[model samples]
Target: MKPAIALPLLGLAPLLGASDLLVKALGIALVALPLLSLFGLLLPVLRRALSGHALWFGALLLAGVLVGLAQLLMQAFAFELHRALGPFLALLALPCLLLVAIEPAGPGAGLRQGLLFAACALLLGALRELLGHASLLAHGEWLGLGALHWQAAADGLPLFASAPGGLILLGLLLALVRLKP
Candidate 1:
């Protein structure tokens, strides 16, 4: 994402917490990203149609409406996941707005972000669930992926189950990814 978006994504957080929620994290990334990009695509047009003051107000209204629509969709398609996602879904609007603030050079931009996030989400979710919960895809049933999960007979590291531990695990993962070849 452009700096416009990255700044907000980093700040709104709980995106990191999504790792703890597994299925809910996947649901948001799969469902919300496209809607965000679609709304984002229209930002330039809306910005052009309205002046400075109206632009801010219009964007806010649009963001709210979009968020509502996203929530409704979540409620409809992923009711359980939506409930699990809780208010964190509201924070998604920040990324949507930031993504739209800067024009994309091509259609692939959103796809790139979505795919990368999805992959990271998968890795983080799996890692957290494995070490933190001693299970892989523990809530897979919540997303109709029951076959994908299996609980272990042994216990896991309880620390990874918490938010701060997710951050630590994430930092460790980042370091691993950034290691020089």
Candidate 2:
């Protein structure tokens, strides 16, 4: 797959998983930034040390390790969220590996890509929550906050809360981005 499509396609699952709740999205962004930042910094150096299949294996291993560490940290401090995220947290590694493969050049490029992904996660998460539940951060309690939420409507488009809704919203957003001036 092309580099651009590869990362998002691989990442779509985790993005959908996290976008179910705004708090979950925050959890993902918090984890993704550091994971990608560290991964970005370390992978370039590791690439210099390996080649061929070894490089791919090493990159996968590295991404897995980084994701595992984030999972452990989440489990410890955010047990509820960790459980809610479930396998989706592990699926995060796929995008990381793809990110590493596509931008093996330098940390900055990888980090920029990571930031873009994290931003998307946050944007999608917030939009989904607002549209689906008519509230933002409505379940901060899930993240242990329990006190911060904003409700603006009695009901919202429930479809936005589901997987299909996420895909539809994503397509619309992609279409918007592709629009010419």
The top-ranked prediction according to TM-score is 2
Stretches > 4 Å off in candidate 1: 1-12, 51-56, 100-107, 176-181
Query: What's the true lDDT of residue 141 in model 1?
Result: 78
Candidate 2: worst-modelled 10 consecutive residues by lDDT: 1-10
**Clash totals in order:** 0, 0
Superposition TM-score, candidate 1 onto the true structure = 0.80
**Cα miss at 5, model 2 (Å)?**
3.6
Which digits, one per residue and each the tens of the lDDT, describe model 2 over residues 1-181?
3476645677656887668778988888888888888888888788799988998899889989999999999988898988877888887787677765574556676577678778888889999998998888877987766788888848989899988888888778778988999
Q: Candidates' lDDT values, in order?
A: 0.70, 0.81
Q: State the lDDT of candidate 1 residue by residue for 1-181, as single tens digits.
A: 3465346345236467676756756776775567556665666677678866787688778877888888898899878888887887776666555555555545555455555566676777778888888887666777899898778999989898788888888779777977999
TM-score list, all predictions: 0.80, 0.91
What residue pairs are clashing in model 1? none
